[model samples]
Target: MKLYFINEYLGDIHNTGVEGMWVYAEITPSKNIDKFNDFFAALVDEENDFEEANFSEEWVDDNNWFVIDDENRKKGICIPAVYPDGVIAWRWR
Candidate 1:
């Protein structure tokens, strides 16, 4: 139930599709154990949010979160480098 907005470019050269994304967030308990397990079910539930949304299993395998590219990349907001909430944060803002 937490949200994050990483203002810094954290990905490295080895990372492709996301490495150039400008910014991204890492959400844990991501997709959840239930949905994740359902994904591997022999007969996957066709109605699953992930399946319905057409999110690749690989995307789920890797962490999933919000990503954005905005002119205000590092503007107007700031949070601790290591936030106490340990849930949501706006790094390097």
Candidate 2:
């Protein structure tokens, strides 16, 4: 599954920085949303000791997660706090 980081500015798990910047996922033939969601949920769980306020570039890298660069199409996990909604896939012609 393709993970997306919706909000990068505001530090709110329930609220995204942008009005419509909700966590989104694009499931491909090789990707599974259920697995990704399960993994993400575990990380965000309070018992996991994950602190949204402590999220950082180094932290992401250490945790085997990454951000999306528009210029380059790379895949990696993103912050879970901003992902309050379901995955979205758009098709345009």
Which candidate has the highest lDDT of all?
2
lDDT of 1 by residue, 13-79 (tens): 1111222423224324333333333333422334543243454544333233333334323232232
Q: Candidate 2, clashing residue pairs?
A: 1-31, 13-81
Q: Give the Cα error of residue 78 in candidate 2, in Å.
A: 6.9
* TM values, all candidates: 0.17, 0.30
Question: What is the model-wide C-alpha lDDT for candidate 1?
Answer: 0.30
Q: Tens digit of lDDT per residue, candidate 2, span 30-81?
A: 2333434444554556667765455444434423434444454544543343
Model 2 misplacement above 4 A: 1-31, 47-63, 73-84, 87-93
Best by TM-score: 2
RMSD of 1: 13.2
TM-score of 1: 0.17
